[model samples]
Target: MKKIALILLVFMASAACKTNPFTGKKMLNFYGNSQIFPTAFAQYDQFLNQNKVVETGKDAQMITNVGQRIASAAERWLSANGYPGYLKDYKWEYNLVQDETVNAWCMPGGKIVFYTGILPITQTETGVAVVMGHEVAHALADHGAQRMSAGTLQQLGAVAGNVAIKDERTRNTFNQAYGLGSTVGVMLPFSRSHETEADRIGLQIMAIAGYNPDEAANLWRRMKAKSGGQAPPEFMSTHPSNDTRINNLTAWAPMARQEAAKFGVTSFK
Candidate 1:
């Protein structure tokens, strides 16, 4: 049973790979847009219905405007790079929700929400572009589907271990060790890599949209300050540390600007 399970896992992984055009890397993704998008859209609708969605306000309008521009930039980049229909399945929607969470997020198929509390950090429209770009990048990269795929594989690995171990005590021990080891060694690092990828992609798209890429790093600095230096160690955390993000964004800003120049955008906002 264990051997069969291992074989099945390997087969699935080999067959379920998709190439991410932006990164030009093949990633494991068991779920397709058809399967993930509808569910995400439904959940997003439910959340908006449950929350206080600010429909008529300056901040709300700004969120929509920045989101549309960033998304358009991404589409332009994709079309120019030979993936003309990459975003065809994506139904883009952005809304501002009245909340104090100090965060924003995007669903799989371009559903985005900005919490009111994050406006202070994103003080200007350019600053808002920084955050909007990051969130949109996650959807563009299909990080949510990748994460689900990874989780499925992680569970299968544990199941294989359990089936292979004959002794009950040994099986229990393997489960505990596998849970911790897989999370820290594989899952956490995977998540961190996704975050880093999003940051880089976001910077490029925001720049193409005539927003300053340098502000990406500055946004992270403000994020660090807001966190009060309280965060888990890098290895244990799902996202990269604030300092790491700041440094990465700073280094990538020039390249982003170069990319924007290809689209005839030289002056940033």
Candidate 2:
């Protein structure tokens, strides 16, 4: 079992290397859109049906518009970089849900949802664009699939450990330790890296979509103020602190504009 686990890990690491065009980094993604998108689409549909989805309103329209523009901008960037039709398989859909959670998320294959609670934080259309771009970036980067693949490997490791450890008490102790160690040391950091990457990539796409990349930082500032400095420590959490994101976005705003210039987008709203 141990040998099999090692072999599987090696195979996945070598065979599942997918190059993320925007970042120039090779990501480990064992599942493709074909495998993941349908599930995400179905789940999204189910959620929409179960929840109070705001289907017709100015806010709803604005959410869809920004999401579409961000997705288009992402496609333009990809096509310009010699990866045309990269999003052809994506069935993009954006919706606004009537919730007070102050959250927005994008699923695999471009399914996005924005909660009503976030609208106040995104005070303007441009602010909406900032949030939309970040969510769209997650879809474009195949983060959902990558996370699923990573989770699979983590479970496999646990199974291998259980099978190899014949002492029942020792195995139980190992499981407890391994769970904490892997989650904090590996999974949390991995998730934080994805969030940071999404922030950078989202900034560029929002700029190209004619939204001010500088607003990305401002949005985080609002988010920070809204949170009231009550968040888990960065090292212990799966997300970077609001302050870290604010600083990173501020520094990257100029570069995002430079990227927008390459696509003939000189002015931003």
Candidate 3:
């Protein structure tokens, strides 16, 4: 029985192995792009058809323009870095939805939705680019896949630990303890890393798209100001603290600008 179980575990692990493109990290991923992308695309289309998608105005046009530029930048970077046709499956679409929530997100398969309420804080095309770039970076980096991989590992670890323990009551207790430890120690840090990486990559993408990387810092400042001191600390949340994020952006901006220079981005002020 134990031999059979071990064989099964090895097969499962082998099936789940994947290599991350951006970080080059070997990870366990049960789902592939072929499975994830189609689901995301369908969900995105359904969302647009159900929502009040803004159209026929300057604001709408601006959203589309910024999205297009970022998408172009992503394609260029991917191809130059040896991921030719990386975005061939992407059916990119951008929409501004009429909402009061100051939030935005880009789903996998290149669907982006920006809430109108965020525009006031974004304040300019550069600001919008910063936000859009970050969201797009998340998709481009396959952060969603990373997240799912982490979750699967956690579940498998829990099950293996429980099996080793043997006693039902003790196994339950161990599982509970493991859950708490993983949430605080592994999950939170993993989420924070993704956020920081997104910020760095986003800055570069925005610069490559001909938007000023410097605007990234200012955009965070505006986001902080708009929050009115209500956000949680960086350690406990998925996002970095405003100050920490801004400082990191400031440090990374020069590098992004230099990268853009190679692509003829001369004036990023």
Candidate 4:
């Protein structure tokens, strides 16, 4: 079982690679949009049905507008950079929910949701653009599929470890240690890196879409205050610290403007 698991892992690693056009890095993504999108779309549809989906409102319209602009900007960048059909299979949809959680997320194939609680912090259309770009970046980069693939491999590895350990006491100890090591040392860092990448890519795309990239950091500043310094430690969390994001976005703002300049987007909203 252990050997078979090892072989499967190796095969998956070799067979499932997709290049991230924004970063020029190869990502492990065993599932493509065909494999992941329908499920996400259905889940997103069910979520919308179960939640209070706001319609015929300014906030909802803003969400849709910002999402479309950010997605178009990403598509423009992809097309210009030799990935012309990168988003051909993506069916983008954006909806605003009447939840007070102050959060937003995008599913595997561009299904997006914005909770009304975030509006106070966002406070403007450009602020929505900032979040919209980041969420869209997740879809563009196929982070969802990659995460699912990684999760499957992680579970398989756990099973393989248990199978190889005949001694009950040793197996129990290994399970506990493995869980902590993998979550903290591997998964947390992996998620943080993805957040950082999305920050940079989203900044550039938003800039290209005629939104000020500098506001990205300002938005995070509001997020930090909203958190009241209550977030988990960076190493234990799945995302980078607010301070880290503020600093990185501040530094990347100028680069994003440069990228926007290439598209003749010299002014921002």
Best by lDDT: 1
Write model 3 residue lDDT over 11-120, tens digit each, in one string. 76678666555567665566667878899988988998899999869999999999999989888888887888777777888999999999999877778999999999
Off by over 4 Å in 3: 1-30
In terms of lDDT, model 2 sits at 0.92
- Tell me which residue pairs clash in candidate 1: none
lDDT for residue 50 in candidate 2, whole number 0-100: 96
- Winner of 2 and 4 under TM-score: 4
Q: What does candidate 1's lDDT look like per residue over 203-222, in tens digits?
A: 99999999999999998899
TM-score of each: 0.99, 0.98, 0.90, 0.99
Candidate 2 TM-score to native: 0.98
- lDDT for 46 (candidate 3): 94
lDDT of 4 by residue, 1-269 (tens): 88998899889888776899999989989897888999999999999999999997888899999998999999899999999999988999999999999999999989999999999999999999999999999998898998888888888889989999999999999999999998888887988888988888899999999999999999999999999999988999889999999999999999999999999999999
The residue-level lDDT of candidate 4 at 99 comes to 90
